[model samples]
Target: MKYVMVFFFLVLSILSCRKNKKDLINNKIIYNELIREAKQFYRLNDYSKAADKYEKAFKLIGGINNTKDGYNAARSFVLAGDNEKSFNCLFELTKSELNYDSYDYIISDTIFKPLHRSTLWNNLISKIKDNKEKNEKNYDKLLVALFDTIFNEDQKYRKSIDSIKNKFGMYSPQLKKHWETIHRRDSINWKKVKMILDEYGWLGKDKIGKQGNNTLFLVLQHADIDSQIKYLPMMKNAVRKGNAKPTHLALLEDRVSIKLKNKQIYGSQLMSKPDGSYYVLPIINPENVDRRRAEIGLNNMADYLSNWNMTWSVSQHLKMIDSIERKKNDIDFK
Candidate 1:
């Protein structure tokens, strides 16, 4: 009878060890699978699937504490139309040692096209501290390289400019050809031109005007606060002039007031144009701080902004004039 009891104890110990081992192996598999699957979905632009896989992985890995996984998860969430989850994931990422590149990706990536001017987004701006030294160094290096390639071949640059002009008109008929000439005069002066646009409230218009329907928001994705401030006024003016729709303009106004400055005003005057193309102006504001918040707001605006004119703003017109001065050499478009 004593031997029988000892045998039973031994069996229980073995079973317990086996269970632990299986759990460990399974947890490892979940991590590996999630990472692999997330990459696959991302490559295909299947953000929804990628987000789900990432979420599952996060759970199995024990949560947002995993910085690399968290970063990818948040990015996937942005693509998946799950702004809340993306925001949470980004917030978690901020708590870790993620670098300026992470924050830069949030700011510059076109995926967050809709949320550039939100107050909630602005509130989160504190998360990305300035990396001026690094940014300047990087920018200088890239700019130098751009100039060396574009300086010797004026004709090559002219063709690129024409392509930009032709494409710009497809999305924004309002863009003037001369503006691109002015924007690219120095061959390597895009940075200065961008800064000038920002200072003058004409930022993001060039790129936005140049893209097609699918990439209209790409410019807005990089817009800053100053640019949004400049754009909202224009949108308001369009509304008051009866050039745009009240409903759509009102929605943008509401988002700006609530998510940007939280200032509210009621007016019967609205824009006469459709919101589809016009919405891109505000979305491109460089000061746009949070991808998730901006995306949520943009998606919501889509229903109302459908018919808006795909035209460029006055500032955008100016940028076209600026783009003509570029000197092309050998910089790969990629």
Candidate 2:
């Protein structure tokens, strides 16, 4: 009777642990879904809805301590013209445990432009500067300058493309002229980036901070394929050493591979057919692609592809690849 009781208690304990784990997973899924919806609203320029969703997500994830989420909520609120909510969120972020080193983003980010004229913004900036960690580096000013230059150029490029699209649709002959101008500007910027790389190798997080490193990654993404290939090893090493993110390396590697007509190891890049259907560019091992992606902190292929208005299924991808291979074999035999 004693043995049976002990066994029953142990079973109950195991079931309790499983239930807790399942609940945590479900919570994380819901949290991510909320974030995705917020981002979608932001992309659609529905700033008020985006701000509310972001704040709701932050609250759902134990509000006060989640500094990153709080900061995001604040930014979105500012964009939405909600000064009260924005100030509240920003204050919470400043008080949170996370050591946000850079105040430059608060000053320079366009979303915060509305807040700049307010006394609250000045006081908040003063408070953050006073409470900043003693050992924090001050490279953010330089980093912000670099980011501003890149951002302005990118905005111009995007606006030109959008104008052409809005006026004449996706495949207008007029797009050729706009693209040529964009490409020329991009090449000039790429030259500047190359000079920066020569002076400061790859700008890892240690040197310039995460935001700066992200800006560098954006520049690299816009660079010619050869430049991306040239820096692939350096970026990969940074990722391995935990100085950089795996996602950037994965994207660069996949892009370079696709350009070379070789199978990509991580399926980050996609191709669009003339019929508007999108497919994963040839990957080395489609069977375990999601596993590799998950290991690198990426979403599953299906969820990631959905951002581009594409649907993905592992089984369908496998079948498609198999059919392509069979067709190739038949042609070779003939």
Candidate 3:
């Protein structure tokens, strides 16, 4: 599931690096559909079916050998009681493809815990450790540790939102206190991230690893507008250089747009009002926004909003847009 979440933006970079643009659009559509169905099967706990569909999608994008989703497929295979398939999938992954960051992704997923008991597991672990050592040999170890801290702390308070709400109710002082704590964490993270950027400009994957580099965007996106506005171009440049994810940039772009009271292009930004009801921010050409989203390798708008328990239908979108227009001052973010 984590790989499915991360695969979208990474696919864009892979597609761009490929030589053939011939029928690329058609292939992307097919790949996305397969991934969607694979996720559905995963949700239903049909691990065998999920693994099959996931492999098909991976094949379309040049196989799990080159993508992080290889780990996801392997995890599914293990869950489906096919240890051989999982080993083969991981063999492909460890072959000149994974980096230090990927090694962590492979080990940290608890589904792979059973593999540790196998005789072959030691061989795989050795190969993965070698990959990590080789790839991160030139990396700034200190910066990597710093970003790791920032990334972990960024979610520390946000993870408590649901529990706080459930225990004390929405808008209660306890929930409000939780948000205040979140803001404090965000501020501390922003200060560290800003200092890193000032000293190093923007760190690339080679220097900080993928998730470490993402700490820059995560902190900046949560920053005040002055901070977001300042680093926006730096992030765009990072995306252009294949150092950052397109989906990340699209999200930050929408966040900045909403902060400026302009329409969001990708429909990634939404607003929550005082009563806890949410509204989608006004999107430019809400009809074709999904196409725009796909252009940069985002899932369709419907899937992205599902986490909020919101549906994205033509009628529902129009109603939200209409309400945003009617109550201009009511929405805090818009």
Candidate 4:
């Protein structure tokens, strides 16, 4: 009788644990769904609804885990004319580690321009600056600033290309000159990055600020394929040593694979159609792509693709690919 009672209790405990885990997953799904709706609202210019949805999702998650969503939430509230909520949201960010990591972006974002004149904004900036000063106390601040300068220059031309396109049009002489300028800068930046990597190795977020550390990847990403191939092994080792982010490594992997005309493992690469639609590039084992992405700390494919105004479903994608292949074969035969 005693043995049977112990066995029954153990079975119940195992079942209870399973139930709790399932419930946790379901809640996470719900939170992500809310965020998706919030982003959809923002895209549609319905700032009030976007703010409401973001607030709901944040409440469900207990607080902001990363600065991106919180920044979005604060911006939404500002656009919706809810100054109090916007202030509260930005205040919440100062309480997180993103305080130092996000200081530059938050300060520069034009969406927060309205809050700039207020006392609250001044206080927020003071707190964030303190966080940054504390974080950099033991590091070489000049080296950190140097990496930041490199990163800004690396991004300068790329960020301006869209505006230049609007002004001069694609394939125009002006655009050609712009590309030439960008390429020249890329060459200079690549040489600098190679020198740094050779001397100091991979400087991840811990050593440099987020943008500073990201300069390494950005420079190499803009370089020739040979440079990317050269650094792939080193980046892998950095990830193993906890000196780099696995998510960034996944993107570099996708870039190299796509350039080599091989299937990408994480489905991070996307190809655009002439009509302006986009589709994910070839992925290995489409059914398990999301599983692999999760292992590397990437979000769900559907959510990630939402940024590009694309919808994703592995089943739908596979079927579309099959249909296209069949049509191609029929035309070739004819």
Clash counts for the predictions, in order: 54, 0, 0, 0
lDDT of 1 by residue, 1-334 (tens): 9999999999999999999999989898667767677767775678899898888887886776566677777778877877888777766665535433234335654556555555556545455534322333434344333332332222233334435645565335434444455445532343433453345333121221111111112122223445445566655564566443444454455445534733322211123234322223223332231332344333222222222313334355335324522322223332
How well does candidate 4 match the true structure in TM-score terms?
A: 0.82
- Tens-digit lDDT track of model 2 for 49-167: 98878877776767745666677777778888898899987877676476554565566666677887889988889767654433235555575567557656644665557557657
Candidate 1 or 3, higher lDDT?
Answer: 3
Q: Which stretches of candidate 2 lie over 4 Å from their true place?
A: 1-19, 44-49, 64-81, 99-117, 124-168, 172-182, 272-279, 319-334
How accurate locally is residue 163 in candidate 1, as Cα lDDT from 0 to 100? Answer: 51
lDDT of 3 at 251: 93
Off by over 4 Å in 3: 1-28, 44-48, 56-62, 79-84, 97-101, 152-187, 224-226, 237-243, 259-262, 270-280, 294-315, 327-334
**Against the true structure, whose lDDT is highest?**
4
RMSD of each: 22.5, 4.7, 10.4, 4.0
Superior candidate under lDDT, 1 versus 2: 2
Better of 2 and 4 by lDDT: 4
Show the lowest summed lDDT stretch of 10 residues, model 1.
208-217
Which scores better on lDDT, 1 or 4? 4
TM for candidate 3 is 0.69
